[model samples]
Target chain A: MSFSPLIQQLITSLRCLPGVGPKSAQRMAFHLLERDPDGALALAEALQKSVSEIGHCKLCRTLSETEICDICSATDRDSSVLCILESPIDVLAVEQTGGFNGLYFVLSGHLSPIDGIGPEDLGIDKLLERVQSSDIKELILATNPTVEGEATAHYIAAQVKDLGVKVSRIAHGVPVGGELEFVDGGTLAHALAGRRSLL
Target chain B: MSFSPLIQQLITSLRCLPGVGPKSAQRMAFHLLERDPDGALALAEALQKSVSEIGHCKLCRTLSETEICDICSATDRDSSVLCILESPIDVLAVEQTGGFNGLYFVLSGHLSPIDGIGPEDLGIDKLLERVQSSDIKELILATNPTVEGEATAHYIAAQVKDLGVKVSRIAHGVPVGGELEFVDGGTLAHALAGRRSLL
Candidate 1:
């Protein structure tokens, strides 16, 4: 016999997660029901609160509860230099490096014409407006090094080039602590083409 | 800098699901917030409803929203044969096979004294009472083939052998369609030991 209605519903709804399939959904549903009901309740509350309350930052378009994100509104960060990324999670990745102290602009996604995604869909106009209206001197393109990301970066560079803002793309190379022998061909080629002289 | 408080809480809460780590949790959180907020809300409601309403079946102790599970209450199912398992998930596995039409008894866990789990904790007394009070003629032990499961099955068999009920453990051997050369040594031994001759 099939599971009771509520248990079946729980398993079905859990399949909406990115990587969860029927088997994983069943495991997760039973795990929550039998071993950790409190955790299930807490996760439910967290999902409800975050989905209903979180919104995009007005200045950066990053996920935020307030009008402006903490990184954008912080006084210690440099607003003159902006790092443009494909999604809010990328913002966290750059922040974790403890290197960038500048403001950020999240595009939410890259240019994907086949999927009907355009510059307007990703708020490119808003990004251009922010750069033109503010005292920003440099714009860093930190989108993923994929076809769509490269196209999106180039398009944005052309848009802001005439506006007198210095535009730069993040370097593509073999990752630190990685051996050259194991590096992918495309990345190695990019590293060779973009190498700088130590002298 | 860390994510905004709400985003951070959502990521942390998502980690409560099995096999979800920090990276997967973050990806799931952003995926829900950006692309599928409606799915997130639905999942939250399902989790809340299932965790609060689902309880153990009165007869079989499998997870059920009703007092008696469908399998236990069905008139067509055989009451003379029972399958003893370690968890509710096993019931679903057996049902999917469509080979057995008997009731089930869920132990929730096998005996483990070091973890402070014993027969009483697993409701072994209740299992005995049900077998004695009902017309059950045979019991099939379908717990995992681990050490603890073997011990649990043997203990239950000893308890019920004197009550005039036939008791048996599921066989452990090379699975159907699996190559004999690829089978493990332990399973090969079991297969040879349990081999039956065809007259």
Candidate 2:
């Protein structure tokens, strides 16, 4: 009944993924060894390569292979406007829409004191340095709508207010395809208060 | 918005896992590269090593690092009793129960004509060879209760009937925690048909 120690090790290693459990890890290990070893090899090499090569951008703190990220280094992007987000994934989310052509400053994570994460842990001082030193006119807070995200945003806003940078937040409202009846009270209230007038 | 090609490749390769999608892959890639590079490297090495080293057993067709699986090569297990199952995972399931001390033959998959799988696809001939060459007293069909599994079990039974081998199918019944009302009619029927006196 017991699998070989190596097979057991492979299964345990796969459990490092976000949502994977023991059963899923076992399935993944079996799949990698059985069905597509080449694909599995690619994933293996990719994991090592990405981990070795990828690092946080000096300016934005987003994932990059070099010292600076593409978005941070791009000449066309508006450096005068910066978008703040909880993670690099949010940067990708905003970038995919082509709606924001501004530079970004990734917090890397929200301020969660329970997890020993705070403003300092999120590198908020580095963000303040960018605002104080640059001609940045707008700092858009695009962190998640969770309590920690809101607290982090408020903290950042207060820190940058003296620098004369106009701080804004991405709107919180009912999702476009969501029904109002299913929407939570907090979201509905934000939607009502942040309502826009039609031209 | 597009990640580096290495990151992209990692994400794409992660999708090869069962139930993994674009979003989870991205999350996994980020978690590996960002949070735990050492653990990521271990996983990478494990994946490569397992894929390269692991192979099917010559006799039982279960995962092993050699020409034959440990279970098939073991002398302590009963050689006269053979259990046929649809996958190596099923072998683990049976072995874990501490019930079966017999030898095993893993089909790897069941008969699925729609997917171009047949008796040959499952290497039924190899199983037949084992049956013909060994002093097998009993053959237990432990395939799933699905239509394809049933068909596969029937096909196996027909192929071995003339060999004087006593073939038996694993019982079908309601799951342990399943409510009687919620149990499928087929399972309920099987339960009724297989009922024995509890004396």
TM-score, chain B, each candidate: 0.97, 0.96
Tens-digit lDDT track of model 2 for B3-67: 97777888998888888988999998888877878889999899989988888998989888888
CA displacement after TM-score superposition, residue A123 of candidate 2 (Å): 2.2
Predicted structure 2, TM vs. truth: 0.92
Fnat: each model in turn: 0.94, 0.79
Report, for every candidate in turn, its global Cα lDDT versus the true structure: 0.94, 0.89
lDDT minimum window of 10 residues, candidate 2 chain B: B1-10
Question: What is the alpha-carbon lDDT of model 2 when measured against the actual structure?
Answer: 0.89
Query: Any runs in candidate 2 off by more than 4 Å, and if so which?
Result: A192-199, B195-199
TM-score of chain A of each: 0.97, 0.96
Show model 1 residue runs off by greater than 4 Å.
none
Q: Highest DockQ: which candidate?
A: 1
Error at A66, model 1, angstroms: 2.0
Tens digits of lDDT, candidate 2, A58-135? 999988888988888889988889999999888888989999899999997998889998788899999988888889
**Clashing pairs in model 1, backbone N/Cα/C closer than 3 A:** none
